[model samples]
Target chain A: MDLLERFAKGDDAAFEALFRQFEREVYGWILRIVRDPAAAEDLTVETFWRIYKARARFDPQAPFGAWARRIATNLAIDHLRCRRSEQELPEQLGAPGAPNPALQREAREQIQRAFRRLPAKLQAAATLAFIEEKSYDEISDALGVSIGAVRLRMFRAVRILRKEFNRMGLKP
Target chain B: MTKLENHDDVRAILKKGFPRIRAADEEPRRDLWPAMLRKLDAHALRQRVPWYDWALLGALAGTLAFFPTSILLFMYHL
Candidate 1:
């Protein structure tokens, strides 16, 4: 039986298998959008839980990967909205005694900080387009926006990120 | 004078500025399944109504019983 068929039949093993398959991509997509490991992890688990809860609603004809990603992306967007209202930012990226090489850590942190500074929609667009390397059509479908809007958001996000990078004295 | 446009400069800068951190290979610092289980339990718990809400419901029923005309008024407003 297919994964969704097995899932709908209440097969725990199939569910676990599906989780293992999509977990990394879902987590990475959420992380790129939220820029917080903790929040991303929480959202990743929540996404899986949601998927499990809504298994019966899963359309067998639709691609499971896209469906799972849409769920993850929506949760990430909701988390960002809630965090923005609370004025909570991610913890400073390069805290003291970090594990990664100093230069790499700093670069990552800088990029994350710049990403966080963007408006939530722009951040989502940039994360999907550049970080996830999703095509515009895929992004539009995942984000539930028109393709034109996706292009506009991506353009605006790139412009803003470029400006922010230049201001930080980061050169190509 | 208008500043000279540098489209290629910005494009190059963006290409370099994109972070190379790959989320695909990176493992979360902590296992999240336990927390997920806790959340599931919490959700299940939330489906059960509390006694206070039951009491309030009882009170509403009592009020409605004592005042039958209020039902029409409530229905009208709704």
Candidate 2:
């Protein structure tokens, strides 16, 4: 609580502690949305920068985690929207600096092939929950869906990921 | 014999059948402190639109648009 107060008051140490606590989670959450690590990192930094600029205005009664997630969510969505009109995949996320060819080929063949086979909703939901580590509530906010809907999507996604993992002899 | 209580085949199958899910990789940053600090700052800065605000706006708009019309064509008096 004291930490929250300090953070509310612009104490760097308090802010540092808070960042350490949620950095990966936030980054993962955004990455789940964008599906690109490099992009996610950039967005993560941007999200935190926005947080720093907006901290004083936060309501103490509100859930801080959800609040921060909202920022990252909007930013990630804005990013996706910006990219929507672009036909080709961007250069950075292009096929250039990926894994070694053989491994990449296998991984891509296995992952992308299976991914494409699933419904769009399932793919999005699974990646967000499993890969991103977002809580149900956070996913609901990010996706702008109800809690029940998020859980249902997550349940189906888990099944798909488990099935895929099993096919690859990977432990779920 | 209770189904697979002491069945080696079942145990082996169970262990072998489970799927492996690899975790996503973390970012290159050494510490999350900076990011978290930023998250708090960002959270505080939300331009939140509360439900009541919307409700009030809707009500206000309704009031402006509404006109009182209390004329009964025929009122039956007993």
* Deviating ranges (above 4 Å) for candidate 2: A85-138, A144-172, B1-21, B27-78
Name the docking class for model 2.
incorrect
User: How well does candidate 1 match the true structure in TM-score terms?
Assistant: 0.64
Encode model 2's per-residue lDDT on A36-104: one tens digit a residue: 677788788788777777889977677777778878877886776555332222112213124577644
lDDT of 1 by residue, B19-46 (tens): 5457454577776767767876777676
lDDT of each: 0.72, 0.59
- Quote the RMSD, in angstroms, for model 2: 14.6
lDDT of 1 by residue, A9-109 (tens): 76778878888888777787778777678888989999999998998888777888889888888898888766653233343333222466775557555
In model 1, what are the clashing residue pairs, if there are any? none
**TM-scores for every predicted model:** 0.64, 0.46
- On a 0 to 1 DockQ scale, where is model 2? 0.07
Q: Pick by TM-score: which candidate is best?
A: 1
